[model samples]
Target: MENKDHILLFRVGKSELERIQQKKAEVGIRSMAAYLRKMALEGICIQLDLGDELTEIRALLGRCSSNLNQYARVANTSGNIYAEDIKDLQQLMTEIWDNQRALLKRLSDI
Candidate 1:
């Protein structure tokens, strides 16, 4: 109906044009351009969320790696786990050690 006010018909195939109209109705959009804009905005939002998620994951991993190292140092120096964090830190160190040992041995051989 809005197209009646416009000079351009856009000349798309029947199926494609129908799909565009269907999506426009589903999104409660008033025009084809608005539907297209909504689709583009959704795509951009997904990519932004993915990037933020990856950044958070990397930050957590860095914190885990740092905490493991701190635990190893404190255990080696203090000889006792007086604090809960110290105990948890040691467990993290052990987990890191277990994971790295396989690679460490291979690297040492080379």
Candidate 2:
């Protein structure tokens, strides 16, 4: 490990500080010093706006979870599971995989 024996200090304007804080939050970094150091050293931060993809994934997962719950309840009470329920789950899985692949492709492009 490298020993830290030096102090590097700098100042930023109010607007600049606000921008830094905003970017830090966007990247989910809690330490301002670390964020600044990373920016200074790496000089490249790729912030992907995955909101739409995440929302779609969440909706699909919710539907899949609801279907699974219903199927479980039916099976518990009736002691039998339907082929249709299994098919629905398989279809949901396919959609989830497709979305994941699309997201990966987008990330790889970056």
Candidate 3:
């Protein structure tokens, strides 16, 4: 990758700016812009720490899909299906279907 210099702007008190310069010198960071960016990135990264959340969501979706298919088949076959029960199962299936469509759309966009 090509390295490019980007101009950044910051506002700080005189004392704070002096402290920053002193620390940059101590760390042998000659360019204030580079030094500030490096230190700021070290302190915070945005694309963070979602492995557990992703795993949990995956498990939940798997279970929901399995139950949805099972219930859908039962509702289709069972001769004495109550209206409310059928509606409930259909709603759950529809919700899962909608979520799947939305997920696919987002993946395609990405």
CA lDDT of every candidate: 0.65, 0.92, 0.72
How does model 3 fare in lDDT? 0.72
Which segments of model 1 are wrong by more than 4 Å? 1-49, 86-110
The lDDT, on a scale of 0 to 1, for candidate 2 is: 0.92
TM-score of each: 0.33, 0.61, 0.35
Pairs of colliding residues, candidate 3: none
Query: For residue 38, what is the lDDT in candidate 1?
Result: 67
Better candidate by TM-score, 2 or 3: 2
Candidate 2 regions with alpha-carbon error over 4 angstroms: 1-42
Each candidate's clash count: 0, 0, 0
Candidate 3 lDDT, 52-90, residue by residue in tens: 555655765776677667767777898445677666656
Model 3 TM-score is: 0.35
- Candidate 2, 1-110: lDDT as tens digits: 78868779989999999999999999998998888888889887789899999899889999999999999999999999999899999999999989989999999999
Model 1 TM: 0.33
Model 2 poorest 10 in a row by lDDT: 1-10
Candidate 3: misplaced stretches above 4 Å? 1-44, 80-110
